[model samples]
Each structure stands twice: as structure tokens, then as C-alpha cells.
Target: MALTTKGNLGPGRTEQSAFDAVHSAKRKDLWFAAGGLFVLAIAMSLLFTLIGDLIIRGTQYIDYDFMTSYPSRLPERAGILSAWVGSLLVMLVTAFLAVPVGIAAGLYLEEYARKGWFSDFIEINVSNLAGVPSIIYGLLALGMFVYGMGLGQTILVAGMTLALLILPIVIVSTREAVRSIPQIVKEGAYGIGADQWQVMWNYIIPAARPGIMTGAIVGLSRAIGETAPLITIGALTFIAFLPSPPVTGEFPFISFAWLHDGFTVLPIQMFNWVSRPQPEFHIAAAATGVVLIALTFSLNGIAIWIRYRLRKQHRN
Candidate 1:
């Protein structure tokens, strides 16, 4: 059916048109992808611009006096001092509580625990726990530590609560990282007469370093930003004195009282300033926000760098 003089409905025409249609569609798809990227870039630029504005407008208020000044009884005079110290103290406590417990739990589940219904149930519950509102965990801490256990609402209790709040995230991340290791590494260690613990610490885990570090950073970052649970557990909104960074009894850092004491965090303090009637307080809040954001970025950066180094080490 080569076209008669009219060239109507020729097989060659059909083939040529179909090829042209497909080619045109592919070109359109490429353009669509490029357009999507352009939009995404614009959105990201807007976000950066907003952040820059916050820093510029806010940093005008940030100074050495701001860093060292304690919270004032008056909203107008208050600085982020107490909140900064409390956040530092409480976060250290949360880190101490969360890292070991989470890593251990992850290890037990991934490396040692037998595959069974109990394990499945625990896994399901942990996932569920991660999704639980952080405020609920704070309430749990309030009930158990402050009221039930008779510990005052202090930094220690608040830290413990936040620890539990973020524990599931840490555990899940750790487990995934550990699970990513090649089974062959474990087997190789076993063939060399190594014990389970030995293989885990020496071979399998090291092989999965990047995943584990990434997960740890993710979890830790989440813990750092938590406000709800710490609020519930009674992290102090303002402390008159800075707690020492470590426990030596000479300068007390640990919150011994849990029941009546209050605690504070960067976010909570930020909230306080932001809510105040004074524009000056809002300026202080923005400054504190910059510090908080910087802390989070620094931690993430360190973890990522560590992961990269470990990966390179393994490759070499």
C-alpha cells in the first residue's frame, strides 16, 4: 500500500508519525524535568533568602553581652543565657541516655536477638513509638520521674524523658545501619574463630559505618530540637545559675531534684521570647535561633564528615 497518488493511510506514514510522536514526547518530558528543577531551585533560593534575612535582622542584636547575660525577670531585659546553659546541660544528658541505650537495643535486635514473634512485636512497637507525639513522652516523664518516682522536675528527669522520646528513632536508625552490613563479613569473622561480639565490633559494624553514622546524626539532630517532651518533664524555663558542664560535686551539673524543679531548652526559650510583647525580645529570639541552627548544622556536618572518612577508609 505504498501511497497511490493521494498517499492515504500508507504503512510508512504510520511508522514515521509514531516515531515523531515518541521523539516529541521524550523532548517534552526532558523539558518538564528541567522546568521542575528550575522551580525547585527557586524554592530553595527563597528559603535561603529567608534564613539570611533572619540572621541579618537578628544578628544586629547578638553580641557578647547577649551570650553571657542571664535571663532577666523583666521580659525586656531577658537574654538567652539561662536557656542556653539549660539546653546544653539537658542535651548532654539526653545524649548520654539515648546513645548507649539506642545503640545497645539496636545491636541486640539486629545482631543477637533470635528471629521470632517477640522480636517482631518489639520492632512494630518501636516503629509505633517513633510516631508517638513528643509531648506524650514528656508527660510520661512527668508522671514517672517527677510524680511517681518523686524526683523533682529538673534537668536529669527532663533529659531522661527526652531520651526515651528520641530512643526509638535512634534504635531504628542504628538497626538499619547495622543491618546494612554484608552477612559475609560476619561469616568471615566466624570462620576465623571469632565470637559473636568480636565479629560485631570488629568486622560487621565497621563495614556498615556510613549507615550507622548517618542514622546516629539523624537521630541526634532530632533529639537536639525536641521541645515538647522536655517541657512536659519540667526542663527549666529559667535557672538562676549555670550548671557545670560535668559532675564533680564541686560544681553540680546533674539535676538532682526532679519533682518541683523546672528546666528550659533553646526552643522553649525561643518560644518565650517570641511570645513576649517587646520587639527586643523577638530580636533576642531570632539570635538564639541562629545559635541553635548552627549547633544542629555543626553536628550534622561532623557526622557526615566522619561517615565519609570511614567510607574512604573502607574503600582503601
Candidate 2:
């Protein structure tokens, strides 16, 4: 390990010395690069620990009956049934309205529209809209759907607002997906005398299916977690009547009013219970949070599985 006049030269270098230098250098560099990951792991652990503690403390209130019944003032009486139904309705409706519109707008921007002021304006505004506060979207829903349009604070309005709120994200993701398709595919479709619309519908969109599905699912997850807009629309945190169907007096099926109705959602209901002076309410909120987390995770899992299957099919 001594330096000569110019440099240290060994008669023969040990394999272990050579290995240590090579390995140690790489290990040090690797850890340096991965230092951020360690920090991320620590942060995630703290978060999950807090969530886990809350869930464990709250699991008492997370009964199947609680999931299937309406909210009640009595700690022993409350359930998430109405909120759960409303959330499902809102989510389904939002997906129906937003997915197609977002994908179309994305396709237009990336594949059809000429680059210019209008396109640029839309692009810039959309990017900005993605960053706009969720509460701002709530205000918009309150003003436009509830008041201006006279929808009267129903599930429909909340769904529409959430659809718009996450539309930009969907559009951005869809456009990126569309853009990733090789131009050669479009050219080949054209070479076969396919019209532009035909090419897009038959080839281009299918090619981008995985990415589009991923984006739409991400947007759906965001919409599912929304509480502010529903709250702004005046969600009834303790509604009875099980939120019966907007249309039906037959077959014994319960439903909701799409217009002029006060509804509840999991978050808003959880918040209401949580704000109670009882420690039980905190446990309820934690339990509700776990339900929401599970729902979100399931949505993500379904989307990812679909994408993987599609990718596998393409590979085959």
C-alpha cells in the first residue's frame, strides 16, 4: 500500500484487492444514487405505519353492516351505505362522461390539430388546469352545476365536476400514449387506403389502448377520492332512507336522485363522524380511510392488470 517515486507497482495484484476496489467503488456509487430511495422508503414506512395504526384502531366500526347501511348519529347506528352507493354512481357516471371526451380531445391535439395559437392556448390552459386546486373545482361545481345550471346539488353535478377536474390529466396521458405510436403505423394504414378516421379508430387508438386505459384509470382514481366538490354541492352527511333510486317504485330496488338531491360520500361522511367529540369518530374516520384506500388500490390493480395483459398480447 506504499507509493513509489512515481507510482506504487505490485509484483502481482491480489484478486481480493482488485475485487475490493472494483466492488467497493461500485457499491459506494450505487448507494449514493440510491440514497434518495432510502429516504423515500423511510417516508413511506412512516406513512403506512400511521395508516396501519389508524386502521387497527378503527377496524371495530368497519363491519359489513356498516358498509351496507345508511349513516346515523348514534355511534352504534352509523353506516357507510348511502355514501358508498353515491360514490359508485358518481364514479361510473364520471367515467362515462369523461373518458371518451378526454381521449378525443387528446387525440385531436396530438394527432390532428395544427400547431398554432388556439392549440397552444388549449395546451397551456389544460396544463394549468391540472394544477388548479381541487377546491377551485368544488367552487366551479357549486357555481355552475348547483346554482347556475339549477341541477340542485345532486350526484350528477358532482360527477360532472370531477370529470372536468381530472380531464386534463386524462388528456395529457392519452396524448402521450397516442404520440408514442409509430408514425409508420399511420402511414401503413394510409397506404392501405384507410381514411384518417378509420386509421385512428381501427389502428391508432387500439395501438394506444394500454396507455389510454392507464390514464383513464388514474383519472378515475382521483375522481373517486374527491370530497370537496360533493361537499360543496351539500352532501348530507347523515341521510336516512338509504338514498332510494331516482326512478323506481317497483321490484324493491333502492336508487338515488340524479338531480335536486342531497347525497353523502365516504370522505364527507367520514369527516362528519370524525369531527364528533367522541373518540369513536376518529376510529370511524380511520376505518373509512382504509376503505377508500382499498378502493383506490383495487382500481389501480385492475388497470395495471389490463395494461399488462394488453402488452403481453402485443408481444405475442
Candidate 3:
């Protein structure tokens, strides 16, 4: 009996030591979780404080005139009509140029491009471009489009610049989404006599749409809020007149002239207001910030909804 008890004591001590190690690990995990939560709380608190302040100071200014009237010398009379319109036009141009091209490049790289040095080189460059600063894209656009091509400080220039800035993001997202698709799925498509093009178009694209769209919207949200690139391209700070619509009452009813016109976007307009010495203009800047935030958050919300819907559908 004494020999048996002594032998059992060694095993008991081993068990206790193992249990203590697990408990210590769990405690460490809890501490890490607590630290993460504390950091997240601090960040969220700051964001809410900013939003609350903007609402308190800017809500009264968000009326019809504020939406319709152009910027003015007087703070009370100023509105974001020209700014919003320019932003809208620029975004339209950006979407038109970026979406199709980015998706196409990504698809080609993932599906069709030969796994060679050239393909590797392209992939490396794209990944690098995704990390490049927005201001660099603006400088590139300034030199290439503005000075070289002589596009001038136009809506098209700003839109194309932003489109280029966000291209790599879309491409990378596309590759990741497409890469997630099972090879067996494509093999099944091939077994049914489907070509590469058909398989990609009918199967891969639909499967990857959710990720592609999420990235696109997020990229576009970033583009819309960007100021450095536009400012670098010498976007107008103050503008009162609206661009001519694509149609005009003349022989050439359809025109592309509006793309060439000088423009001021929301961020640029808000920056202009914020730079002034007047207290009223500061309030106006806050009001403009509210509008900008609304636009950005709306896009983000749409992206989130799309992602949620896709996940639910996939689960179903």
C-alpha cells in the first residue's frame, strides 16, 4: 500500500502541472482579449465623439438650400451644389473606367495568364501598386495626363487618377476570391464540354461577385474621400457653375465636353472652408463633413449588406 501511494504521487503531480499550464494559457488569452477590447472601445469612442459633434453643429444647415445653392463668399449662403455635382460626375467616370478594367485584368491574371516570369512580374507590380500612396498616383496623373496628354484640370483627369489608384485593390481582391473557388468545380464544367471562357463567365464570376463587389465599393469609398490626388492634380477649390450635360440643343446634341471642364469636389470644397479664419465657415465645414461622411457610410453600408446577403445565401 505504501509503495502504490508513492508511485501514484508522481503521476498526480504531473497531472496537476499539466492542468496549471492550461490554466495559465487561458489566463493569458483572457488578458489579450481584454486588451483588444479596450483598444477597440477607445477607437469607437473617438469616432462617435466626432460624429456627435458634427451632428450637433451641422444638422441645422442641412436644408434644401444647403443642398442646392453653390458655395458663396458668405458662410450662411454657401452650399455644396457644385462640390457634390463634381464629386458625382467624377465618381461616375471613375466607376466607368475602373470596374470593368480592374475586373478584366484580375480575371486574365488568375484564369488565363501563363504561370511564367512575365505573369510573376505583373503580379508583383500590382501588389506593389496596391501599397503605393494615393498622392503618388496623383503625381503620376499630373505628369502623364495633365502635362503630357494635356487633359488639364478636368473631371476626367481626377476620375481617371482615382481609378488608377484603386485598381490594384480591386485586382488583388478578385484574385483572392477567384482563387478560393474549388478546382473541381471548374473540372466539372470542363467535363460538361464547357470552355475556359464559359466556365469563368458562368461559374467563377458569379461565385466571386460578392468579394469583387465588396472590394470595389470599399475602394470607391476610399476614392471618393480622397483629397491629395485631386489637390495634386490641381482640382479647382471654388466653382459656382455646373457642368453642361452630355446633351445640348445643337447639331451635336451628344457631347463629351463636360469631362474637360474644371471642377471642385466635396473634400476640396470642405478643405477650402476649413482653411478660412471665420467661425461660421468652420460650422459650414462641419456641415460639409457630415455630408461627406453620409456618402462614405452609405457605400460602406451597402457593401456590408451585400456581404451579409451573400453569406446567408451561401449558407442556405
Lowest summed-lDDT stretch of 10 residues in model 1? 252-261
Stretches off by above 4 angstroms in model 1 are 1-25, 73-77, 244-262
The best-first sequence of candidates by lDDT reads 3, 2, 1
Query: Which one wins on TM-score?
Result: 3
lDDT of 2 by residue, 1-316 (tens): 8657867455366776786797789999999879988999999999989888977887777888878777766767677888888788788778988999999999999879999999999999998998998889888888888889888767778778889888998999998898899989889999999998999999888889999999999999988888877787677777775544656877545455554456777788778888899876677778888888889999999999989998898667
lDDT of each: 0.79, 0.83, 0.92
Could you estimate the TM-score for every candidate?
0.84, 0.86, 0.92
lDDT of 1: 0.79
Model 2: which residue pairs collide?
Answer: 244-255, 245-255, 245-256
lDDT of 3 by residue, 85-203 (tens): 99999998998898889999999999999999999999999999999999999999999999999999999999999999999988999898899888998889899999999999988
**Count of clashing pairs, candidate 1:** 12
Off by over 4 Å in 2: 1-28, 246-260
Better of 2 and 3 by TM-score: 3
Hey, what RMSD does candidate 1 come out at? 5.5
Off by over 4 Å in 3: 1-14, 249-254, 310-316
Q: What C-alpha lDDT, on a 0 to 100 scale, does residue 12 get in candidate 1?
A: 61
- List clashing residue pairs in candidate 3: none
